[model samples]
Target: MPADADIRERLEAKAFELGFDQFGITEAATSEQIVAGFRKFVELKRYASMEWMAERIHQREHPQNLWPEAKSVIMLAVNYGPKDDPRLLLDKKDRANISVYARGKDYHDLVKKRLKAFARWIVPEFNCDLKVFVDTAPVPEKPLAAAAGLGWQGKHTNMVSPEFGSWVFLGAIYTDMELPADNPHRDQCGSCSACIAACPTDAFPQPYELDAARCISYLTIEHKGPIPEEFRKPMGNRIYGCDDCLAACPWNKFAQASSEAAFHARVELNAPELGDLVGLDDKSFREVFSGSPIKRIGRDRFVRNVLYAIGNSANKAYLPQVRTLLADDAEEVVDAAQWALEELS
Candidate 1:
């Protein structure tokens, strides 16, 4: 077996070669701070309808609890920072605003493939068992990454890296081999409130805290049923996830666009016409968003989101699109259309 320092050095080199922008090592133990914060978020019902956070609290709070044999966690970051500002799309109300992360190939697939590649190379050399995770697993990714010194959890509650800003996708490899852990990062977001002020829905109830129930990302994506009337106007043209808080981060000045081709924005998804997207039936929806993460929500939820954007657009041209969905089989879609029609009227 290789020395811990030697393996750590080679692992980082391999990670970068595999297109990961940052790499760090941390012990597979959860911090009390992370557990406390998560419990508070859950206790407040801020996790919204995602009850799974509470369900898998133990696994999410403790990395060792997740995998007893795991001794080290290799935290990695892949920069998906947009070539141009994602916020620019917000002004074009006729055009739908897909978040920067979703405008390209799904990072879950892209990041996981690279993570497995790195794991394959390391496992044989170090003679250790390993497991990998992207976002789907109940992993304490941000807190673990911060503990690994890859970044610090910003006031926006997203991990903010000095080099990648908040636009990086995180993944982890849990290995039984012991690795030298990196020094934990200290908070770098001193006296800055830009991210807090950028929220259209006022999602931040306090600094460094978020009410996910009120988040545009949650409302348009994870949330089922019609969005509350109070949040619809603030949802604006963001038919998918919202990036205002991420874009508002001052650390982003150091962020360069991702070099990975797979992460680059797709032209069609960029500023897509609300009218065009709203017209997508189940078949066409699958065809258009075939490999994109947006496809997961299916046509019903997606069309519902587009209708809300149309209503907020104040552009009567999309009224016909809204009308066509008035009788959608999905109750949420019909409710969204009716609400949109009323808003537009």
Candidate 2:
């Protein structure tokens, strides 16, 4: 066998042994094809209040520009699928739904740790310097993963592994090691509009373009102020991230539940009672979600999300719970709570 072929095989085996669900390697090459579209998207101010996206527009669109020394990027995907569709709880009006991704340990920490280990192993073998990232850097992970033959970028602008759908969390190791690049995956979303249609806020302006401003995920996690009333009703029971678009993907039928114990859904997070969540004081909230991704949003934004869910509950039983938060110290939380209480009353 060729030396490079043997190295690639060894790398894949090592990745599997390290618990990464999928691995692919791609050369650090820039794609000018998508640059114009990405620029247009930014020019249209579709990034909403994410000023960082505007600031790093050029770097994000071109991977090599981020690190000129990087010769290859090893794209890794770790499955975080839940035993049940996260969207199933939407009909349970009194419950708050946390996105599958945030149900367990924070992925940023988990993925970065694993990537560091993988990099350490590779450095000795290839004598290369490695830098790792897990959504923390300007790395265009989804596009790079596609270029690496890991999967195609779905219309939702998330990587959709044919093996795991959109349930994979992406991580990358930028290395100076010269490795053979894998063939890119083809777009498998033929004649499918489920993701686009399922978005409550119509976040997708076109097949492959997403206006982050209208996305519920952005509103609940990234946007810090009051959520517009228009999108609240359609927000349904989602208290954190929205998974409707992801669940709607046809490829999900092929997805298996993730084997990583750290990615498993905590029973409490799966279908938390809106009343219970709203009743949590800052200390209790931190203690309950200590190691989970939800804690990063802090108590105020989390309570704001819970209030939106409470308003959409249509269950009068939660009115008292929503009412208690009406005088929350945080202005944003209090505003949302008052609006929810008024709507439910």
Candidate 3:
């Protein structure tokens, strides 16, 4: 018998101990369809300003390209489901509506820590070498997770678990030891177009493709400069990320609030006021978002998002803040401030 040929139980035991919600293993192979879909996503320039996707296209083309001698990939999911429908915040014109994923401590840091712990246990127990990844790498996590039977990629192009829905965060453990692969999860998105209608910017070109340039999440977090005028109005109060598509999915009805405290929404961040977020300076922003994924955008870009929400707020109360931000040093901030001021006028 092959040594450590079957350790799914032990693997899942440790993964659950490390706070992961779901676990599955799959051979390190990307199907031709998966490879082509990713290539098309890049070829059609749907990645928008995220040039890294194109740069590492081949790395994601196959798991072995990123790590030779890899036999299997362990996929894990962390449920970050919100306690309430995140869409509830959309009509709160005076408040900032951050995505469910970013309202807490950064999942990348937390998940990577758990993945590292899991790796430390497996390398010695199973006599294998492994590398851990939590969204930072060129790994096609959604497809891989689906392949591992964790979930299907919904219309929003996010992994949707029957167990946890679209609210799960995926992580990977690529190992030299081969493990039994799980049957791929079947697509259950079916005829549901709720996620499609939920997009404020019509970011989905079709049922399963995303045009990031039109996504509010892209406008708020990924795209660094002044947001294009067209997406700004539709962005509404989403000051950090957008959760509409995820929240709109009917599969989410089965999602429970995350058991991990690290994934819980911070008190102040749950529903911060746009008036407050717009006033964040570099120092304050860092202090506020120190452990949050939001810190990556820095004050200029974050405040720019806040200003757009402020403009969409239709409240002249923020007029003074907008006027002051017009004198900000960052060209983008100044541009957003001017736009906010005009909208308020």
Candidate 4:
């Protein structure tokens, strides 16, 4: 049997073998800083339409609250860096710019499977129980990740790794073993404000803060109604999630492009024509996005996003596509279609 220190070292080695780009360990404890920040975030309504965040505040405030027996947390990061600069697609006004992360297989499924495999190996070898989590859990992934020395949270409030930059997907494994914790990472974002300046919607009120209500990702993915007219033009051709902040990080200078085929962009998803996307009805939408993360928002919300993109497109070519949805049963879709037609006209 190996010593606890040896187990810690081997666990990290096994994590890299399992495809996680980075790994670190931290004791599972109540995080008052996380609680204070979350309270303020919810108090200010910064979570936008994500009422679930407010509902799960208690569980998020402390890791032990979620699982009492959890003695340590193993935070892992997987790089999903794009083969080409994701921002280059913005210049193609007639095409929709799906965020790089969403262009591949659903990360929740991929990361969770990898984590479960690691957890399965851990249980038998270490004789300890564990639980794995991706984004779906109420875990404070970023703070715990930073605490585990994976990376410091950047001005964009996303973890920025020295190796993977902002292109890393985070997951966690909580175990009963009291593993040695890695030294916490310190804030390395100094003087530079590229992420703040890159916001198309002025989503950042200040460095390290976000108003999700005005975030393009929130409007396109979470907000389930007619997009406020104010954001339509700034949204540009981005029909799914926005990547401006992530793409603007200077730390990406050290980032390596992801080699995972599972994270590579699907040809059909890369810069898809707005005309093609605007025509997707319910059946076709499901068919096209069958295994993609975009499917979760449903056809109505997706068409709504595309209509906003078409409105901002300044190309008359998509006017007919917008017109086709003028009588859509989803009131928000009809509203967006009308708005897009008026803008294009």
- Residues 265-308 of candidate 1 have per-residue lDDT tens digits of 78899898888888889999999998999999999999999999
316 in model 2: Cα distance from truth in Å?
Answer: 2.2
Off by over 4 Å in 1: none
Tens-digit lDDT string for candidate 2 (124-223): 8777797899997778888889999989999888888899988999999888878899999999989898999999899999998999889999889998
TM of each candidate vs. truth? 0.98, 0.97, 0.98, 0.98
- Mind giving the per-residue lDDT tens digits that candidate 4 earns over 1-345? 788789888999999998999999999974677789889898998999899999998889889989999999999999999877788989898889999999999999999999999988999998999999999989999999999999998999999998888999999999998899999898898999999999999999888889999999899999988989999999999999999999999999988889999888888899898888888889999999988999999999999998988888899988777877997889999999999999989
> Which pairs in model 3 have colliding backbones?
none
Q: What is the C-alpha lDDT of each candidate?
A: 0.91, 0.87, 0.91, 0.91
Residue 5: error of model 1 in Å? 1.6
TM-score of 4: 0.98
Candidate achieving higher lDDT, 2 or 4: 4
